[model samples]
Target chain A: MTNKRVYNFSAGPSQLPLEVLETARDQMLNYEGSGMSVMEMSHRSSTYQKIFDDTKATLKRLMNIPDNYKILFLHGGATQQFGAVALNLMDKGRADYVVTGNFSKKAAQEAAKFGDVHIAYDGKDNNYTHIPTQDELDIRDDIDYVHICQNNTIYGTEWNYVPDTKGAPLVADMSSDILSRPVDVSRYGVIYAGAQKNMGIAGLGVVIIREDLIKPHKENIQVLAEYDTMADKDSMYNTPPAYAIYVLGLVLKWVEKQGGLEEMEKRNIKKAALLQDYLDQSDFYIYETEKGSRSRMNVAFKTPNKDLDAKFVKESIEAGMTNLKGHRAVGGIRASIYNAMPYEGVEYLLQFMKKFEEENR
Target chain B: MTNKRVYNFSAGPSQLPLEVLETARDQMLNYEGSGMSVMEMSHRSSTYQKIFDDTKATLKRLMNIPDNYKILFLHGGATQQFGAVALNLMDKGRADYVVTGNFSKKAAQEAAKFGDVHIAYDGKDNNYTHIPTQDELDIRDDIDYVHICQNNTIYGTEWNYVPDTKGAPLVADMSSDILSRPVDVSRYGVIYAGAQKNMGIAGLGVVIIREDLIKPHKENIQVLAEYDTMADKDSMYNTPPAYAIYVLGLVLKWVEKQGGLEEMEKRNIKKAALLQDYLDQSDFYIYETEKGSRSRMNVAFKTPNKDLDAKFVKESIEAGMTNLKGHRAVGGIRASIYNAMPYEGVEYLLQFMKKFEEENR
Candidate 1:
């Protein structure tokens, strides 16, 4: 059979670079003369250790992460971190959470089980269509840490500026937007992202944390979830997700070769503009997210009606695109043009959208 | 270059069948004409959902899992389940733990944090060389469950008979020997394994639990760690390890085509016999595990001295073999020939051992 690669626009576990996939396929049988697939190598072997170390080093360099911060490749994704962040750091028994969208709301509820969780800001008042401005946040200095979801994938909203947490350490879940743009790693106590998005594959969670917050000896938490132990062991306390991390390493190298985060930010801005500019000009489509808080990763929009939106999604798949249907919570169309989604993919999507709009009208 | 596959025997995350690797490579670019890598597909997409369903169904059939059992794909490996098993099943405030080897000892310690843990039996007395018989276990009928390591990867031992836990339910960590032989799924309440061993790849944990044991609404535990939530959601409560599960499905299919577990057991017995028989007749090597308790997956042995053991490991690499080094806790050699290791691999290993024994002595 012919290798027919198409344009995939799923939100998380979304598209990856075709080049990266090809490289992975090439090395599937024998990885760098190791005489075995990366899937079969022992985590403790020197051959595999190099892959693990290089993956972390590339991420640290790409993020401009300081020596004080550790890059941890963990399992259970960012959803697991919702509890881990609180279990290890909520020593003061209270923390402020900004409920920007679906994931942030889940984080606040999960943290509530571990400590006294205070909602510093709730975007639900506006149907989670926008991120709250810094002045609108009610964060307290007494709290252990202030939590935020940097990018809301489902709601198609992104935090434009970091909130001042009144001296409290900041924790951000960048599951959808990490690696798409540059960020000040020093500003946050912890930043975690699941690998299924712009990073690479699923089953791995990348955590960048300030060294001081990692308490390996933290009581009541499992050893695997403890940031200190995972960091101390260099994230190999036991058998790690070897193949996922290897694929993640390959993706990071691909990003680095594309000229670091600055180039990524420039490209991302252009990709988002391609869709947003079209949405702005079109009268038939309605982009609900406020302009300032719109995400460069996920573009959630709707046609004139539900029936037409369904038809658009159905037709788009036949036209060589998939995963354009929006989240169920808010029915519409969402084109998650992540880093791997080439500019040409967006151009093709725009052409389809325009043709669908003209014909349906 | 040539795809030179070598003999790898490093316990967990060991070698996989070359056929599975070839199939994975063929489909790495576009999985079965879905036009996207499995890593890129959304968990909610019907195309990806079918992969997930087929994988779970294949595992259920291979294990002959009863209808009352729910199979879950989770993160954090079996180590994560060390805490998860206790958090979900320690409802009676305690459980009986049988400490057989490294993993079970760690599991017992982790379970101590959540509930009352009683050491039903400790094999450490024999330096973890053997599994205790039924009458030797001081298990309690009132406990929530009786925990055991079905196969000890580190110490090269296997439970020859399932210990009768009176009326208490049984929980086993089958990380090292899960699919190497037929198992009576109905006899155990819960059996969990890390995929890096007998299953496939790393970063994915397979939990086969009796439906009654799954407590999704179990208070005080994190949502992701709750077995009921994972089972109820059919292991898609969140973004799972997609690529790992896909590879696992391929491995399961390969095993099914190899005439299922009965055939696997037959081959495993022959392979283990080849090594054990050689060790039985050899005077230069020492196999410490009791005869009936020997693991077919991992064969741990030592030379007459530590120096020769090191030399044997160093020379084996040059002889087209790798990962023969033993666990650091016990400094010797451990040849982990899991289900994926062919009979010829074992034959080659025996050939090397004979040559090494003649030269070293």
Candidate 2:
């Protein structure tokens, strides 16, 4: 039935597992005999609260999140969290940011709204080709938190190691890389992510924050902006993205069935390497990203000739590949091999690339 | 196929037209020829962008929205907008709020986070049984905007008339009643709805603001909180709730097929009146709300005996009439007849109510 399905490579709002999609489709008509789609279920209803709680519990167990962290399913996406983290956390004074790419820089800019945002290091000169080493981080005592975009989706770079923020708390925007790999949740004060790429669908952001971090502060902050408002009411403080959270639960279960984050990571590594190794060896294709900084989830590449790059993206779509076109900022091609991408998907792309290279050459 | 389908009457996230649900189900596995769920499509892609554009266009044409208004499909629920509206507007340091019921009062409290909020009138003294009159309003020149929750879902009351804002730029939180009736876009400065009620689903909020209202804001505000940022980028500021928006587009299209908002209002009236008239005439039932202020969207009522209310709710579920229990604050039986609630569904509820009252008596 899915033979007509192409290997969708769109960044962020990318592919979900076929299993997740089917489950959602099945539930879309009448979820568990409720005689209504989950879309039509009240967030305040017990049925939806069960789904919400189960989703949080599954994510916690899968990630091995510590008891100290409170999982919050929030709206307004990750970019909104960039500002929210600053509003909620940067109460003391300054915050530090290691700018690796576009999103990180935006995070720093948003954080700067509340207080001083010191750019500890910047990789803009190198076109955000690599993640800065931990030694390069400038942690200060006055800094409330040190923020990092763990993975640069647009630039195709990943931070393989977490940065030590001295005694200060560490915060990471793991939107692209979340759930694809295991992490020591204790290492960060907050690990927030947009659930579209690896987890579920668009519209909702999952925020994992240390319980102590969700304290009362500035009265000027919006009510819904307060973590307590959501925490106290179990994300039903407002109408939650019930459908998004439902689909996320399905994806989280899919990840567990695929042997948890560790196994998914290993599979993702092999899938990424299959395409990366081929691109590295080919003269027709170029992967100019720094070796250590390459993202296992997203691989951006280009041809030596610009017109050939355009031709490759166009022809690739015709040959059962979709969303292979890179972000307009760095126009070339980007293959986002998220956890949902089957290893065979990379193989499909590799064959397409080789055939196109031979014909063009 | 729908023989087993129960009538859902949850306040928000209530009921959707079966046609819309079926269309969404058929397209769940694949959207158009994209070979992936709409959830998987990148918000930036031309494919999803088309969906977004068509949604906005459909809503605008259906509402007869003037060119002066910018319709924003934003993240966060109506609750989030309570704060966002204050941050984006309330520039002059104060906004007047008429405390009609729970949601409007919450909106006033959230707005107060940014600026001073003057309670023009409070309906709590009467348990929000009726909306405060415009003559009771104390709109001041210093007020940035006068806010009102047009329809009270819990209290089962709706403002039968728009408040004379005295040129303070009227802003209405039209969450429950939006799209069930025609709204004169030019009557108010801004009209925002949570979309779960009458529009589509949860996880998305729609704001129709006069174009001039999308102005530059304070540097301290979050980018997504800024209306200009969304209006300039067509609400793709942060990937949006694309799936939610897609579903919303479907709902909007469904509304259009039902002969637009005018026809929807007529149908909703009949649906609400069917239940209300029966309840009003029944010796076992009590419709305590003021006749003039009653909501066509939500009708809250009660029986002479408290235990009977519980018994009726319990039995109604067995008979496939679910979610009929009223909001705890309004503790009795509440029937929310949004546009999606067919007259037959209300008929089923009426039969159940009559049978329950007879047996209990």
Q: lDDT per residue, candidate 2, A234-283, as tens digits?
A: 77777788888998899999999989999988998899899889988898
Per-residue lDDT tens digits of candidate 1, residues B239-326?
9888889889999999999999999999999999999999999989998989888999999999999999889999998888999999
Docking verdict class for candidate 2: medium
Model 1 per-residue lDDT at B113: 88
- Candidate 2 residues lying further than 4 Å off, grouped into runs, are A1-3, B1-3
Tens digits of per-residue lDDT, candidate 2, B215-253, equal 787787878788888889888878898888988899899
* Model 1 ranges with Cα > 4 A deviation: A1-3, B1-3
What DockQ number belongs to candidate 1? Answer: 0.70
**Model 1 chain A: ten consecutive residues of lowest lDDT:** A214-223
Give model 2's TM-score versus the native structure.
Answer: 0.98
lDDT of 1 by residue, A138-252 (tens): 9876889999999999999999998898888899999999999999999999999999999988888899999888765556677778888888888989888888899999999
Please, what is the whole-model Cα lDDT of each candidate in the order they appear? 0.91, 0.87
